[model samples]
Target: MNTLTDDIDAHALEAAWGELDRVARLRPIHDEDSYDHAVALMNRVLDVMGDNEQHPLAGLLELLATLVGNYEQKHYSLI
Candidate 1:
């Protein structure tokens, strides 16, 4: 099977990630549904992880926050 060390290339990497993405609870926010999902996930992560930077999921929390922030800035901006 094609793998990362096989010189598989970017297309292979994307294809592998796409399979996971299909079942992923969190992904890039493209619309309201995705936006809502990301927000809910972030909230849950916040509740469980809080502001603990050393927590294993802190990076995930940060990424989810960034996704939500970017979406809001694009869709809900007053400017």
Candidate 2:
């Protein structure tokens, strides 16, 4: 069992899902501050994903990315 606070060793997002699941939903990334947190964590994950070309985590990352993007788009529109 891996806790999110534990050092993330696996670079693949899918491989990280079980660990991510442990913490992902616990942190609410809805508002600017929360989203910033999410972005920072996600960017770290992305750094680990560098130049892999293929990773099991890609799909899950894509899903999370889209979710975050949509949330930002909907909530932060100046219009």
Candidate 3:
């Protein structure tokens, strides 16, 4: 069972979440514009994360990557 949520501080989480939301507006990748937006957001996260896999926004970076990847697979998949 995942205990990650068991010890979270709600107030701190809210503030941090708000900050992230202010920086990047993430959503499901769809058309070219959405795909470009996701890529740009991913780059923004990278500016903060660098190569550290344990950074605070690592999960957010991963999520952005997944969104971009899904869109790429749908549109640019190599058969």
> Model 2 segments beyond 4 Å from truth?
1-19, 23-28
Judged by lDDT, which candidate is best? Answer: 3
Which residue pairs clash in candidate 3?
none
In candidate 3 the C-alpha lDDT for residue 48 amounts to: 84
Per-prediction TM-score, please?
0.68, 0.55, 0.70
Model 2: which ten-residue window has the lowest total lDDT? Answer: 20-29
The sequence of per-residue lDDT tens digits that candidate 3 reaches over residues 1-79 is 7598878989999998788668676668769998998998889889988889999989988888888988899899899
- Residue 49 of model 3, lDDT score: 88
Clashing pairs in 1: none
Task: Tell me the deviation in Å of residue 45 in model 3.
Answer: 0.7
- Better structure of 1 and 3 per TM-score: 3
Candidate 3: worst 10 consecutive residues by lDDT?
20-29
